[model samples]
Target: MNRRNFLLSTAALALSGCTTASLLKKSTEDTIDYQREKVSGFFASVDGKKLVVLGADYHYVMDQIGDLPQVLQSPLKPRLNAEFSYFDLDHDNHVSGQVTLQLKGKVSDAERQKLQMEGFECKGFQEEVWTKVYKVRGTRYLAKGFELPASVSKFNHDYEIIVRESHSPGVKRAMVLLTPVTLAMDGVLVLGGIVLAPVALIVLSNTHWR
Candidate 1:
């Protein structure tokens, strides 16, 4: 190819790469915001006959889903450690357990190992299996969770630092089935940005530059 035309093509590719990079960055930020909104900062669930959680600010998935961030923090104002549970007078077989988790959004290698050992099952047998649509009262968010089986360990799923939890009255330990909505939305944006560059390149190549 001629020198001028070759240089033009190269410049176009560089600009396209920059566009893709920007899109990815924005998608990451939006995804973080979306994650926070979905769980409303925190939540709680009852297990067995005790209050295992109340306002638990736990994240089972990470923003990138590749490597856990070095430092992650809950959105709770002045976040602190908590251990409280109350009765759910509004709903039967339901209770509110308020737990303050101490997380800086960082998980170490040791922590990851501990979690793997804990696994995602309980008692090697979880019963009363069923599915339900759990909607966060004030928002339009919905999640599907399952009742944790009779746990052999104190905590059904011993995550990074989640240890022996309580099981409140009539409340059975159930796992919440969640979807990465924000990530999905941002993904579309990234994809669109990618398509644009190729189309731009094609159009440019066809234009009369004489």
Candidate 2:
């Protein structure tokens, strides 16, 4: 191989090996702290079948609805309608891990008790109203009062059972597991290319030298 090609191939092989090792290590790590993913969306159902509908242009989180079909088919369905307003505590414009989930609907005493057991508080009869003000060009505008239920639980976003009503645990795990494998495979291909490139170059050099 030419000196340049040999060096490049060696670098590629080293990089690929490093990448694969890192991915495998990350996959096995048990101490990874996944920050909360903030999302604004509707967690609703049709005829008792539930689904999570995220706001347009927002990213869908695997931890949120990765295994949607399974959750829909599971026996643990909540009778209460869920309104989730996820606020970005870090203002990163990405995933918001802090969430204000408000549940509203008629519930049986048993259901209420179940929710209570799960750390939901019963704040009887609540409503929320807020006015949004903005300016466009030289004109100022007021987006008049919008309303929401005052009953809310501010919690660090984890895959809660209530949120699980529209999520699948299996899918999230699969997605996470597949990513590193795919990357490793790509790295292997690059390493293979690195090996082949040098051999081809070496053959070409020998033929020309002869």
Candidate 3:
């Protein structure tokens, strides 16, 4: 390929290679791992932080009704829900590893305990109001909230940062497990395979092999 065409091909191939990794990330965050379903909208750039969403989905029961599907439904299905995720703490995961904090704000003691039982650690210091705020926005199944990548100190600007959620009998935690470095490395591999391989061939073609 000519120089311009070759360069364009390289970028396209690199991005397309990222698609598979992105899909894998999506499946890991989904309750059902459906190829088309993704909860990534809940995630903002977070200044390109090194973080990851852990596990496939959330498993919990909010109350008696929440337990009914998993316990008494005709065709049995586990009571699983997708978590709403966001990056937390100024301290980087790359430097500090995973650390736990008391989840701030109005989340009830029982609800917090339930999440702790499920292995979710408290992430950030911000008020935990997304669930209540989301209920005010609009109703949807399997909801998620994404805070803006940047921080703002103003009260009126709250909407610009955290996403709101709807009301429901059940409570859920935003969980994560991977580092942003992992995804970055995946991109590097794709760049090496799809982009650099062809460039190396081009260079080799121009110079005689000794």
Q: Highest TM-score: give the candidate number.
A: 2
Query: What is the TM-score of each predicted model, taking all chains together?
Result: 0.23, 0.25, 0.17
Q: Residue-wise lDDT of candidate 1 within 120-145, one digit each (tens)?
A: 11122233111111111111112334
Segments in model 1 whose C-alpha atoms lie over 4 Å from true places: 34-51, 56-210
Which is the winner by lDDT between candidate 2 and candidate 3? 2
Stronger candidate by TM-score (2 vs 3): 2
Off by over 4 Å in 3: 32-210
Tens-digit per-residue lDDT, 128-165, candidate 3? 52111010111122212322122312122111111222
Looking at model 2, which ten-residue stretch has the lowest summed lDDT? 196-205
> What TM-score would candidate 3 get against the native?
0.17
Ranking by lDDT: 2, 1, 3
Q: Which candidate is the best by lDDT?
A: 2
Deviation in Å, model 1, residue 177 alpha carbon = 8.8
Distance (Å) between predicted and true CA of 126, model 1? 48
RMSD of each: 24.7, 26.5, 26.1
